[model samples]
Target: MNRAPGDGLSAGEVARRLGVAVTTLRSWHRRYGLGPDQHEAHHHRRYTRQDLSRLEVMCRLTGEGMPAADAARAALTVHPLESVERPRTGSALSARAGGGNTIPVGGAGPEARGLARAAMRLDVATMSSVITRMIGARGVVHTWDHLLRPVLAGVGERHAAGGGLVEVEHLLSRTISETFAAVPRPAGAPTPRTLLASADEEQHTLPVEALAAALAERGHRSLMLGARVPPGALAAVVGRVGPTVVVLWSQAPATAAAGQLNGLRGTPLVVAAGPGWPRDGLPPSAARPASLGEALDLTLRWLPTAG
Candidate 1:
């Protein structure tokens, strides 16, 4: 059905369509000059088709982890003449010419190269699609170790070198998180016998997320407590849940306290994952997995057997 000229959707309708809060729409309008363009006598402002299109762009970009200001700017610049569908393979990263400043993938394959290019252009759709395809074909462990990790490390390297591409890193991280979350778990899998979390004061959860998805592929399940889980909270959850195995991840030395493992003293297996842990400081009972593959294998072995 074609929307007639001068007929526009109300704020509530637009919000429902976009899957955003009504207040979000108002804030986007007030902050970014993205409100309705259709004004009628004695009635509230209404969003025109063009206005909705711009808002769609804004929502997509922001959802993929672009800063609100940058997303709004990109939204404003989107013309009605552009195609509304997801970008084609060759055309997605067309904005970047010559690939001079692209993210360094370091001997990775075409998929990683394409992902880096998409990330550099901040093309959310292409980045997500590429990641989802890779995960589907390669499974979580391979995709994380081979495709995602190298690109993420490259993004980190670039950011460290010049203090730039923070937005790109955020976008790429968000995309990876979403893709992992969308992976399907096996049917009729036993109740989760393992728990995964970031170490106390740790903010990195992507590795744990990857581990969870990998376990799902093998018909095992885990309870994932994302970023910055405190030591006390970890203890409380372990006591209450009675998980057979617990994996605590710390991405930096600052968050990897050996005492955190002490909190899980009674758990049958405590795996200290990530690089943050000091080699000598780990608890004698805790096992450390050096890579995603090793982590998955170790955790699977610790899962409870069916009676």
Candidate 2:
């Protein structure tokens, strides 16, 4: 016998210590056979120390972004001390979490590792939930710089190396766009004085979107023209709306046409953002923002704070 009934812990107390709900405890029991092993005829079942240990493993793994089913399986099987993180043999999570299809999130925290695993499996709910939770906890800039960028770059590099994982890349991008676009905007915000768009024929737009979301978090508004606006079109928009500042993003050298900045020279502030811009060809009027924070700072200088 692991422990006498007198020494067993209650479900309510276990849940409180684990920072999860009692219902969650019940569900784990119903699903994964993780309920208290100690039972008596007259008294309700109570969890033993070993039970708590397994539940802790489950919670830790799930918190690190492992799916609930896999976490539960790992919880039931692994040695509490030495093998908790390693999922059981033939588990999908074991392969997906560390196998050949992994995304390289160099030196990032557990959250990034979890996010990468979820991304590789194309688990949209886990990916979205992890991203939204991180953004809510640390704000957009931190989440983007620390979490999203590494995974995105990893996926890109992997695809470039062998032209594989294109599906993973597209799914992750769409999920990011949907999540970033969901960042709440200020109510009754003034007309946007800042413009954001990708460079001509440049399809990559997530970095610019990050700047937009960061601005939104600070109660600022910007005209998000989205990806691949031709120079002439940007000029037309500038001529008509006349944004105080416009940010053009170029992710590769091929799209960083210096000519794109030429049309918007009349705009009061033209920010040539992203790595695509040529070192020597930017117009003297074009301001170069080195990071998302710098772009945000530059845009804020042109617009009043929104309520």
Candidate 3:
């Protein structure tokens, strides 16, 4: 698949254009057989235009959270000259018949259902576009609670049922994370007076990311110490920042050590969030906000206004 010298891109150039690390490209090459197809004696390998296109698909799909293997498989199927078109609304649903697999979005609306299908297909471009549009139209909280959460729950449910859409779950989570990160924070907003982090060993940080984005939407700011903050580190951050409000999140019971909350006793308003915490075991001084909406409300109320 080697092409003329001028028609190929070096690994670095491809990585730069694709917004991925060179190391990631190497890993994809090594693990998934998705490397430069052009090589010469005593010379470095170069990626053909087709190779670059395939890698772009790989990066987008994996960035959206598709498993590398699955993304690579999908990427390899594309012809070099073929344009990657956006998936049509409900197209994923229509394509699912006889596939013996589907993401159950429960009572979610068409958008959520469509998102679930897109996720199943590892359609990152479409997924991201859908998320961005939804956030713009419905606001972060509405999109999170209604569209994103339902699809995420369905992905989780399918995985729990042993149908195994781990790639879908990962891709959807990544897409949501990127969408939230893209939210525009207000200029001249006060320094972040709120600190947010996940409990130790709690890898689920989407809720907090959503909360941060939601805060940004309202012109509030927060320091999001994403996922798995050890108790000592958490305490050190609190001591250093002296934030007006500190929120700790945990996504599973195993990560919900009450001691983490207890360590933040001196923080003015310590809130326990997510479903991982035991109802009775939370630090007596900490408040538990039941949902993202409640958490956002509490954080806002406790956040000190900047001078």
Whole-model lDDT values for every prediction: 0.79, 0.80, 0.78
TM-score of 1: 0.68
List candidate 3 segments past 4 Å from native: 1-100, 304-307
Q: lDDT by residue for model 3 over 92-157, one digit each (tens)?
A: 322212223467878877677657656766777878987898899999999999889988888888
Residue-wise lDDT of candidate 1 within 1-307, one digit each (tens)? 3454247888888876765667777776666666776556799887778888888887666544455566666887784323333222333222222315667879877677667866876777878987887788888988988889989999988988889898888988998998888888767777688999998789889999999888887777789999999999999999999999999999999998898888899999999999999999677889988999999889878776533
Better of 2 and 3 by TM-score: 2
Q: Which of 1 and 3 is the better model by lDDT?
A: 1
Residues 1-307 of candidate 2: C-alpha lDDT, one tens digit per residue = 2334358888887766665567777767765666776567799777777888888777667656676677877887773434223323444324322234577888877788777766765667777888899999999999998989988988888888888888889888998998899999877888888899999999999998998899999998778988889999999999999899899999999898898888887788899999889888688878888888788888888877666
Residue 248 in model 1: shift from native, Å?
A: 0.4
TM-score, every prediction: 0.68, 0.72, 0.68
Models ranked on lDDT: 2, 1, 3
User: How well does model 3 score by local distance difference test?
Assistant: 0.78
Better of 2 and 3 by lDDT: 2
